[model samples]
Each structure stands twice: as C-alpha cells, then as structure tokens.
Target: MKQFNTTLMAAMAMAIGLSGAPLAQATTPDNQLVIATSLAQVLSVDPQQGTEPKTQEILAGVYDRLVYSDDAANNTIKPQLAETWEIDNSGITFHLRQAAFASGNQVTARDVAFSLTRLLKLNQSASAYYKSAGYNAQNIDSLVKVIDEKTFRIELTDKVTAEDLLYRLAMGISSIVDSVEVERHVDHDDYGNAWLRTHVAGSGPYTLRRWVPNETVILETNNRFWGDAPAMKRVIMRHVPESQTARLMLERGDVDIANALTAPDVKSFVGNQAFRVEQVKIGGFYVLAMNAGRKPLDNPLVREAIAYGIDYEGITGTILGPYGRQRNVPVPEDWAGAIANPDWSFQPEKAKKLLAQAGYPDGFSLTLKTIAQPPRVDIATALQANLAQIGIRIEIKQGNGADIVSAHRARDFDLLLPQATAIMPNALGAMNDFVTNPDNRLAAKNAGNFVWRSAWDIPELNALRNQASSERDAGKRAELLTTLQEKFVAAKPAVLPMFESFFPIVLQKSLQGYHTNLWSLNRLEHVTKTK
Candidate 1:
C-alpha cells in the first residue's frame, strides 16, 4: 500500500510473511496498549532536554505543567498544577494546587521555585523561552520567588505580554519536576539528564516502567496520579521502524496503535470492520532548508528560483494524497495570521529567468539530501525532474532520518528535506527556533535544529518575532505577522517548505478518546478500549 524505503519494504515483506513470529501472537492484555513508531532520538526525558517528536509523545504523557491548553479548548488558559493565576503590574503569581509528586512529596511552592531555578540553571534545551523573557544564570534565581507553600511567583525583568507568558508556561518544556527526585539523580555536571532521559519525576499521569533505548519504552499508569486514573494500565511503545511491519502487527492484533503507517498501507484498510485508520494533520511542516551562508544558495534570486520551482500540488496530490495539505504559511491555516494555499506553482520559465538573474543562466548543480523513503524520494525526484528543464543539475542523495538531520546541522549538505513540529499552534510557536538562534553550545543541548545550521542572523526578523509577544493587541499582532511573513517570503530565508503533512494513527475500532492536536500530542489518560 504505502511506499516506504525500497530496502525497508523488502524487509517488511519478509516480516509480513513470517507473521508467525512469537511477538505477533503474544496475547495483549486489555489493560495494556502497545504503540509502534519510528523513534529518531530520545536523549533525555527531562522536559528541558528532550527534543525529538517521540520524546515529546512520551513526556507529554509522563509530565504535567502548571497550566495546559489544546486546540479543542481554543488554546485558552486552563489550570493544571496552578489552579489559579493573577496578573499584576510587577508580574504574575500562580496559586499551586495541593498535589503530590510520584514520590509522594507534596508539591509545595519550594518545589515549584526549585524546578524553575533548576531549569534556568541547567539552561538546557528549553530555557530559551525564559532566556527570551530575560532570565539567565545570574538573575533567574533572584527573580523567581515563593510566597508560603501554595503560592509561587515569576517576576520578570522586562515587560512581557500575558499571551506569550501563558503559552510559554503551558508548553511541555515547562513541565514541573520533583526537585528532590532530580537532585537524587544528578551526576557530575549532567544535571540529572542522563537519568531523566530514561526515568520520570513529574506529577503527570504515567510513570516510566522501562526504556530500552531504541527498542521500546514501557509506561505504567501512576497509581498515585493526582488526577483520574488512566484507562490503559500499561502503554508499550515499541520501536518498529518499518511501516509495513507496524501495519501487519496492527492487523494481527499485536499492538493497539500503529503510529507511522504509510499511505498505501492505510488505504488497503479502507472498509475493514476490525481496524480503523486516522490521518490526523499535526503541527509538523516540511521544508527544503539551504545554508543561506553557502554559495549559489546564498544568492537571493537562486533561492527565489527554487521557491518558485517546487510543484506543491502535483507531488502532494500523488505521493501525499489526503495525508498532507499544501499551505504557504508556517502556522496552520485555521489560525489567525495564516496564509493558505498560495500560488507556488511549477514554473520552469520563471525559474530559468531567476537563475539567469542570479548569474547562473546554465543553472548549477547541488546535492539535495533527504530521508531515504519512497514518498520523500518521489518528492525529491519530482523536484529534480522539474528543475532539470531549467538547466539545474540537481543531485539527489538519500539517508536515514538521523544521518540527514545530523548532516544538515553540520552544514555538510547543500539542501535537506526535514519537518518541524509546531511547539504551539500560533505563528510564534512555528518560528521560535528561527528567531531565537543562540550560540552552538546552547543549541547542542537540544540538538537537530535547522535554524542554527542555516547560519542566518537577521536582526530585523528577530525584532519582529519578539514584537508579536509584546504587542498584545490581537488585530495589531495579526498585522505584524502578515508583514513578517511578507518579509520572510521576500528574503527566502534558507527554509522553503513544500507542504504541511499528516501521519496516520491506526487503531482498533473500539478505542476512544485518542485525538491528537495540530502538534500531534495525544493525552492517553482517557483512552479506553471497550473490546
């Protein structure tokens, strides 16, 4: 059905025929749910350090922030740890709910204060959100204070918008940790990262049962969870890298959910009575990232040529099908300040003219590297064919997701095809990494970020991105976003997104309450299996 890498497809074909493998028929308990996916890298479970999508999936279930919001709830502020919050002239003070950590430590204001202080002290992957708000090593401890056991306060150095602060605190990176639990595991300068990557310390619904690196991660429901108990007592996340194998496992009743099935793999199950397939449009965006500092791509006209050269509709219609949408803006089309379905058609003559304008009338050759998958390869082949007509000698290279992503980070490739998951639903969430480029040392903590690799230093765009948070006025903020997109499009800033795509989440018909947001976050607390 769905096309994958040729080699992987062959292996899957073999595995499908050998479905008699003991694992396929291993009786699944009704109380246990098995999930299959391709994990990129999960270095740490510490909310401040986990960076990959799989890491987010697990951490989202294993940790809880002070406040939470989702698309269905209109991204409005909702209480989680902090039951209520009040904003004042100086700053905002949050009233911590009477909750206890997995370790049975009553989550007091000291724990909250300690968690925020630790996050800033580590200055790991997600501290950029606070760093942007003017917290650093020196003053972060001084600014954040505690008032008694129930109240915690975050006093800011500079003025900030409530909208920005709310969403920042709502993010997974802001998940509150058990200060004492983390301290017990901290190693020499490691800050508990090595331990947290494989363990859990938050007050969320699930606790880590086991994590076998690239093989599997098992999560058992927290019996002492502050909220309602989870329906599935155990969530088994197995690393089945091949889509066809995952599909077969689902058909064989081995796993309850198959997260990374190929499109064709999903199509064959169209009318099946036992299984159901869902292609949810998450907050992930694909882009053809170029090193703006490099040659040829450095030319504005050349970058613009490549931008006009992509056949967004043709490839999306064929390879992507209903699984992806073609949109021009970074944010989802439904959100404000979003521009949808713009005319980025296949234009050979225009591309040639732009190339000539950039002093490359004969066109130039460059290597385009992407994940070695059928759909991705098909898209790259389409681009190669389309640009060839304009005298561009494009070389297509393929690798696993990790190899390609690592190469992009090193500036070792001419172009790379990658996807970015939206941290939040808004425009700021989509482009935060682009605007908040810090030193490589800071970025290494997160790893696999393209903004730092592009080596772009646009102060104007940075200021504009910062302005959206401070502006506060909804209409004026939208206007600022419109102008920002216009400038980014005009500049053709290294990243050229072909389309926004979705992935299929196949499961049994009886399972309910497994809705993922634009960012592909599914809270598994309420998922129930009637069958």
Candidate 2:
C-alpha cells in the first residue's frame, strides 16, 4: 500500500510549505483550512455558467444569493438577500434585506434588477442558465418589476410556479452585483468584476485573495459580511484531480478536506482513523443520448428499443456502487414531481427483437462521446458493455470536461454520455432545460447538428407539464405529477440509469460545524477547528 504524505497530498505543496515560514507568526492554528479537490483549474468564478461542483464550492464562499437553501432543514429556501415577500394577484414581491453588500456598497433592489436584467440581455456564456431556470419566455419579459429601491416584483407573463423564479435566484447568475460595476461591464458580457473571475468582491463569509489556476486558490474571511465571519481566517484549495491523490492527501493530513472521492475510495477513507467521509444523493443523473436526426436513430422504434436494451441494475450496481439508486424514468424520485415508470424494464431480448423489426437484423455501429473524467468513463464503459449484449458496437470518444461539453454542443458524436445536476429544490428547472428546450436536449450535444426529435408527443404529457407549471395548489401539482409520470414512461424522453451518485466530502475528524446543501456549497461559514 502507498503511504500518504503532505508533499504529495496538495498540489500547492511548494507554496504551502514555503509560505508557511513567513506567515507562521501571524497565523493561529485554528485560522487556516485547506481543501483538496478533483478539479484541474478554477473554470470560472462567475455564477452565470459555473455549474461544476468546484465552482459552486468556491462561489459559496465568495457569493450570496437572494434566498439560500438550508441543506440541514430539507433544503428550505431561507432569507439571504430578501427579508420577506408576498405573492398577490399582481405578482411575487420581495422585501430586500437592508444590510447586504457586494464589495462596499449596500445591496439594493437596483442590483437585483441589474442582475436579473443582465441575465436576459447579456447573452453571455451563462445564457444556458435561462433554459435551466425555466425563464424560457424570451428576454424574461415577465421576470421582474422593481417596486422601489428596497422592493421588487416578478410578474409572470403566463401563469407559472414560484419554483421557477426561486430556482433562478438560487443559480449563480442570481448573485447580485453592484449596479455601477454591472454597468461598467455591460458591454462585456463577461464583466461584473472581471477581476472577480480570478478574484472576488461579494459579501459572503469569505473573499478571494489569490487564484493560481491548476495550483491553489486562497480565500480570507470576509470582514464586511452581514452575517458572522467564517471560523477559519483563510482557506487554501488545491486542485488535485486524481482521486487516489486526494485520498492520500486526506490520509496524510496535508489537506483538511477532499471532495468527490469515488465509491471504492470512500471505503478506504472509512477504514482510516484520521478522516471522516460525508455523502448526499443529489439530483444529478447520467444518460446515454442517441442522435434523433441521423439514420438508425431517427426512428422512434429504434430509440425505444435502445432505451429498453440496457441493464440499469447492473450499471448502477457495478459502476455506481451500493449507494446508487436505479432510476426507471428521467426524473429522480427525490424531486417534487418525479414520475416513476416501472414498465421500462431492462430487456436485452426485447431490444434485439425491436432492432430486427426496425430493419437491422444486426445492430449498427456508433460512437460514444464522453468526458475523460472517471465518473463519465465509468458510465461510458458500463454503457458499452451493456449495449454490446444487444449487438450494438460503440466506439468510445473521450476528452476533458469542457471539451466534452463543447463537443456535445457541436453535435460531434452519435451517442454521448452527458450528466446534469438539475437545479434541485426545483424540478421545474429539469422540465424547462431538458424536456422542453431544444438547445439543451441531448441530440443537440452531438456536433453533427442532430436535433432531439420529440416524436413521442403526447397532448396529455404536455398538458400535465403545463398544469404542473401553472397550478398554485400543491395537491393539484402532485396530481399533475402522477399524470405526467404515467405518460412519460409511455413516451420515454430519456433513460435514467441511476439515481444521483452521492457527492462525497472527506474531512479531518476534528473539523466541526461542517454542512452540505443539495443545491449550494457545503456551509463552511460556521466550521471550527475542534482540536
């Protein structure tokens, strides 16, 4: 067995070792914390499109939203930017919090107005968020109405659920910025503290100090935050993409925390005495999407055949491990309106029979594009093995995370494994982005310009979705969900192989006050050094 060492644990080994001698006198033992992660670089700190776990982890420290989900309390939206608000016939109104600030100025209704408006106007790379937030109404024309400097209203163009706007605020784009700063960068869709992409100016419990990509990022406690300061004076996050390396670092005491350790590695951490591992089954799901516009896949019978061909049980059990939940439908059971379909059973014989009926006695050859990351690789391999049983020969194509996403967007592959962590605490996000939107659909990810042809159009399905979106009554929404689920399995939008794999966070046993939210970063604000 390889022994874990501090020098090998954190990628910032040289900096942490050398910088310590100079700052030793000023630092208290409890004032410093180090996090080890499986990220190559800090992709983007701007919340608009920062969907990766690492970005969310870092942003959670450097930014705050209008309302935040209390992970400990069943993911309830607690007040952050707004103190309270009421929804009347006119629209939803929010009473702004008086003490919030981004840098130095007070966070006002104008900032909220600016943030919401920018999301509609900028067409920044973050524009993908609009699809996910269900603000599909072009330009978000019905999004907001500023009642005053301290109050704002969101008037829906059509009857819609509060869940839609709530999820939008929860997204990174919803993090308010100074109105003046936003104006300065208005021409630059990438603006809002361009300096913040590498540095930060938010009013969260922590502030960015230094970011050296692929090496380390350092954050200091935010003195101007409206709430209590973070327990640690400084936080150092080292980018270590290798799972074994992260585990070794945690074991050696070089890194105080290690995130996203795989299932096998979780067992190793549990066997060790110095560390503790935590996990949550979030709303993320991995899928094998086929091109609906191309030959062999254009037929609905073929798509349906492929859907029933794979063994979800074997895939989840072997590739995802014991904790992983098998999903028979596109939506996870944990979501509010999850529609479970028990009929989509794993039947390879049925798949082969369907393929024969679809014109090919022998299954066709196709390519599978996926990220080079371990989880994706695992899913791809499992898919390959399962598809082989049904006579389909798949060529696996892999690349970096960003490259894979770009490739998908460009329609570069025949089949692709794409995973999305839905903007949970709100299922409407999933509906808008994956189900209804054309751009976000799986076939859109293929570089060949292949579109996900929704041939299984059921008027009942559309009606249920609309009902779920417009109904204010919780009972009616639940009833709509039941109707939707029944219709969805019959249409087969996408295959849900496994429930979300658990996001694992391993930490030093002595670190106290740790918390993880399903939608936000693990709350490190109240964390303390128990030792």
Candidate 3:
C-alpha cells in the first residue's frame, strides 16, 4: 500500500508538472487549510444564483445568513447577522448585530431588505422558497421592511407558517449581502447578478481572494468580521474530481481534506492514525424515479411492483456500505415528524404477483438512466440485477450528472436513479420536493419539483402538503406530516426511495474543528491546522 501511494504521488507530480521540482511538503502550512473536492456543479458563487451544494459550502464562509442551524440535527436556531429575532403570526422581526462587511460597509437592516429584494428580483433558483411563500419582485420590497438601522422585518403570507419561513431564512438563499457593494456593479438592470456571479459582497469570516473556474478557489480571512475570527488564515480548495486522485493527494499531505470519496477509498483510511474518516447525515435519499408519464409505469400497481423488486438490504449493505443506509420513507428518520419504518422489504414473489396484476405477467423491458459516478452506477447495476429476478429487464444508460438530471427534468426517461435532498432541513421541504405536484402538465415546466419530474400528480397529497406547510401548531403539524408520509407510501408513488445518504469526508489528523451540516454549509471559520 505504501509503495502504491508513492507511485501514485510520483505520477501525479509528473502529470501536473512538479516532477523536476520538490514535491509539496508532507505537512501543510500551519495557517492554511487545503481541500481537494469536485467543483463540477459549482457554476457560480453568487448567493442568489448559486444553487449547487459545492457553491453553498463555499458561500457559507464568505457570507452570513440571518440565522443558521445550530447543529447537524437542525433542531435549534442560532444567530448569525441577526443577534436576535421575534416570530409571530404576521411576520418576523430581526435585531441585526453591529457588524461590518468585508468592504467596510456597516451591516444594517436596509442591506438585509435590499438583499432579499434583489433575490426576488433576480428570480433565480434561490428565489423558489420565497416565491413558494407568496413573495414576488413586485411585492417583495413591501414584504421585507427596515424599521431602523438595526431592525428588519419580513411580513408573512397566509400560505406559510412562521416556523417554515424561519427555516427557509436560515438557508444560504437568505444570505445577507452588502447592498452598497453589490449595487455599485449592477449592469443593465441585472441587480448585480452578473457581478455577484464572480464576486462576493458578504460580511462573513472569509473573503473571496481568487476563483478560477474548475481549477482552484482561494479565500482569505476577513479581518473586519465582527464575530470570532477564523483560526485558519487562508483556505484553498483545489478541484480534484476523481476519488482516487483525491485520495492520493490527501495521502501525500498535498491536501488537508478530501470531499466525496468512494466507499473503497474511505475504507482505506479506516485504521490509519494519520487520517480521520467522518460521516455526516445529510438528510437526503437515493431514489429510483419511475416516469409515470411513460406507459405501464403510470399504473400504481406497476410502481409498487418496481419498489418491491428492489433489494434494499443487499444494496444498502454492499453498494452503499458506509455511504448510506436503507430508508424507505421519503422523510429521513432523524428529522422531526418522521414515521416509523414501513414493512417494505425485498420480496420477489410479491413483486411478480403485483406485476401480473398490473397486466405485465410476462414482464417488460425499460431503460434506466443514471449518473456515471460512484455508488450511483453501482447501485443502478444492483437494481438491474434485482429487477431481473422479478422478470423485469432494465437497460442501463449512463451520462454525466448534468445530462442525466436534464433528462430527468425533461421527463424523458423511463426510470432514473438520482439522489434527492430537501432544500430546507424540514419535513415540509421533503414533502414539497417529493410529494407536491401542483401542476402536472408538460407545459407547466416545473422542473424543480421532483414529483413533477416523475409525472406523479396526486391532488390529495398536494392538499396534505399545503395543510402541513401552513399548520402553526407543532403537534398538529407532526400529525399532518405523519399522515402525509403514510398516504404517500400507501399510494405507491412513482418515486421509490431506497436509502438515506450519509456524506463521507476525509481529513488529515492535524486538522481540527472541521464541521459539516445537512445543507453542506461547512463553515471553515472554526477550522484549525496543526503542524
């Protein structure tokens, strides 16, 4: 193993033009934290435009939301820019802390108001939450108001509960920006969307130093930050997309942390004292989405047959291994309002019986679309094998993640294996994504809705989602959510959730205080490195 690592490091050095020079030191600089991760999905760093998880992780350090989840469980709320807040039926009022932007502008309620107004005006992917809550560009300015230099208020619509709105505000989409700094670069009435794509106007503990797309991202400490200063002076995230390459770089001490390692690579560091493997429950599920718009799949019995045919234990134990575990329900078990595990298990006989009832006694052939990446490809292969046992023939077709997702969004696939996560850390978020499909028409173009992508439209589930979203009482909300999940499982929806994902990350032993949460908001401000 040692010899293999050495050979790998040498090959990497030669490939990257470091063959003739001294290789990177075995120990990284004491004041810097280097990370190797895939930035393929990170198209923009703008808080209002960047929707990818990688982009959210990067912005977490450079920007501050009004509030933040206290921990991975997302059970409590903590203040960030807002020192305190008061929630009531009509709206929420926030008391802003006396802080300064990286650009030296005072952090004020007006900036918060403008940031939200700009978010709605841009109408990017980040605006989905606010739009769902009944806010739009025309009325957003009136909804978000500045009472004083330190006070901000956001009016609530009848469609959403205060708790629901608060959870949404804690997300990266609600990140407060420096209104003065951003407005200076507005172009063609774009509301600084064009400039923010490449630049950051936040007041968090880090400032964007340099960004070369798909190559490297550099962040330096923001000395003017009002909160506790970050221990690491600088952070450098290098794009290392391949798991093997990231493992080699991490083993050689060229990087301090590696994100998105395969199960095999993660196991390689299990007993090594020099490295630590950490897993965070990201509250997402790996699901098999059957396009109901396609014939045969449109029948509920056929969808149930597909679900029964899956070898949940086999896949979770082998293919997923340490990466994930079986979770049949749409809502993750750790989250609030989750129902007890259902009696869904692998029973080929039951699957065959259901198929025969659905008028496919001879079985049928279909195409399965999946992302060409770790675990996903392997999981798709496992699904193919399991379904074949029940007389279903699955032709596996693979593509890049983006292409596969584009096809799924277009409802152009018979079966799609994709990992779906809640936009917020709440059951409502999951229901909104996996169960609510207000309009099922192709002309609706509701690409963001996963249920719509699967072409599953159920008015009863939609009504339940609305009730749960607007329920103010915690007890009543929990009951409503429980009923929602029960009804979803009973309906045998087109989306069959297989496992809950536990995101695995590796770090050098010398690194400390590195934390991650459900939204991938890995704030590096608290991270420290020892040499």
Q: 520, model 2: CA deviation in Å?
A: 3.6
Tens digits of per-residue lDDT for model 1, 91-138: 789998878888988888887777777777887646766776667778
Total clashes, candidate 2? 7
**Candidate 2 local lDDT, 198-279, one digit each (tens):** 5455668888888877678888887788887777888888877787987776766677887756667765665445556566
Off by over 4 Å in 3: 1-25, 72-74, 187-189, 334-336, 423-426
Off by over 4 Å in 2: 1-29, 40-42, 100-102, 124-143, 186-199, 271-273, 334-339, 343-346, 426-433, 438-463, 494-498
Ranked by lDDT, top first: 3, 1, 2
Cα RMSDs, all models: 5.4, 6.4, 5.1
For residue 341, give model 2's deviation from the true position in Å: 4.0
Which of the two candidates, 1 or 2, achieves a greater lDDT against the reference? 1
Of 1 and 3, the candidate ranking higher by lDDT: 3
Best by lDDT: 3
Steric clashes per prediction: 5, 7, 0
| Higher-ranked by TM-score: 1 or 2 | 1
lDDT of 2: 0.65
Taken over the whole model, the C-alpha lDDT of each candidate is 0.73, 0.65, 0.83
Give the clashing pairs for model 3: none
